[model samples]
Target: MDCASRKFYHKHEFDCRDFLEKYCADKPDMEFAEDALQFPTMSFHYVFSSGFVKGDVLIDISMGPLIHHLYSACDIFKDIIILKLNEGCNMETSRWANTRTGAFEWRHTSAYVSKLEGKSAQIQDKEMKLKEAISHIICCDFENENITHPVVLPLADCITSIWILDAISKDEDEYMKNLEKVSKLLRPGGHLILIAALNTTFFMTGGERIYILKHDANFVINALSKVGFVIEYYAVQMRRNDSTLIDYEGVMFFTFRKTK
Candidate 1:
């Protein structure tokens, strides 16, 4: 399966300020309780506070340059391996991790995560910690099922996949196959922290439209269970349909333990 997409991730402005100003606030489209703010805030709350297993390695198989989901895993895992589907995304994330000049700045995102955890005054400190925690960034593909290629890397204690399957799979069958590939990289009983946009058909990046799998919470739950994941925690934030910026009906986040 060819995972390449014509639309590149670097073309989009995933700026922290822009994201915060647009979706994180309580607007006419989103209420205070069910706004997009819940993703980052609640993700942090769940991973750190829910007795989730912490170990030597954590793999983040993100579809784009976004690293907001990595905030919670930084402190918990000793080594954070960011595996990207393309070179552009790999370089983008690595640039940020290495503090390179002109890197897509995420200090604001780090600051917000800190503020959510009652450490509002320690924004810079959080950024530094996240940078240190990230060990490497490399190219990987879910379809290949050999994410590390010639070198077989050690199985990770946990895997965090956010909005990746929707971007890669054309249908539920392919989605389930990709899920199995991801499951192979985790140790038995390891945790899988997944987040996805519900009922999303497409997303715009760099003026180009990218198709996505339109699935709801039940689809994700059933898929995970069939793939031998025991559901531990699940939640969803119903997306308000008033915004044209992104067309998604809702957001779903869940944590599951690999049963076999």
Candidate 2:
């Protein structure tokens, strides 16, 4: 596929519902579930349970309106703010948050987290806590100086960005610049839990091929270092499924602390 022919997430109209159905749905037959839903949810649960991330406020800048990654976070953070690149995503998330009709079901994901926490019976309670923890869902512009513009948000104690940088960035320079912009959202000494898809060029979603910056772990480590973030933990999970939805070799998870 021609790279130029691919759709850019920032320029395209993302179908949030379609995205959920394709990657995040609870169907046992979904090919992308292991990578899209399980890997992130499990990694997050472990990160929070192991005492690696502790914060009163967490800001999530992830692709789509996915909340599976935030299940464990709700237990650790008092406030959770989600920043999306478009209003559609924000509205989709609000639907789930408010328990509106036709919202994508996340109980399976939450149940997985609960099982990891050894409280499988408290799945409902876990979901309730996460809903209550989400304080705001605001639209943001990564290219703007003030990502959230007009609404100055409190510096977060930790920020979680999952598969967002690669999806929106057109090249390495833009990726680095966006990384710098995201770093400013954290206060000094705050942690950033970042997850990236390794060497993925494009992902098929909503019946369209979306572009992803094809990069490796070394580039990410160097970028984090240059942005004054000290990497404390890094792990890579090799791709488990042989799905053509996305050609990611593996998923890389990093825990970094801001030094300045």
What's the true lDDT of residue 249 in model 2?
95
Model 2 off-target regions past 4 Å? 1-4
**Residue-level lDDT tens digits of model 1 in 1-260:** 23355332322333333333344433455442343444645675667656666777888886576676677677788788888777666777777788888676566567667877888898888888878988888887554668578657789899988788777777799889989988988999899988888798776544456667889888998999998998888878777556566688888888889999
lDDT of 2: 0.89
- What are the RMSD figures for all models against the true structure? 4.5, 1.3
Candidates in order, TM-scores: namely 0.85, 0.97
Which parts of model 1 are misplaced by more than 4 Å? 1-38
- Candidate that would win on TM-score: 2
Q: Which residue pairs clash within candidate 1?
A: none
**Per-residue lDDT of candidate 2, residues 162-214 (tens digit):** 88999988889998899998999999999999899998998887888889999
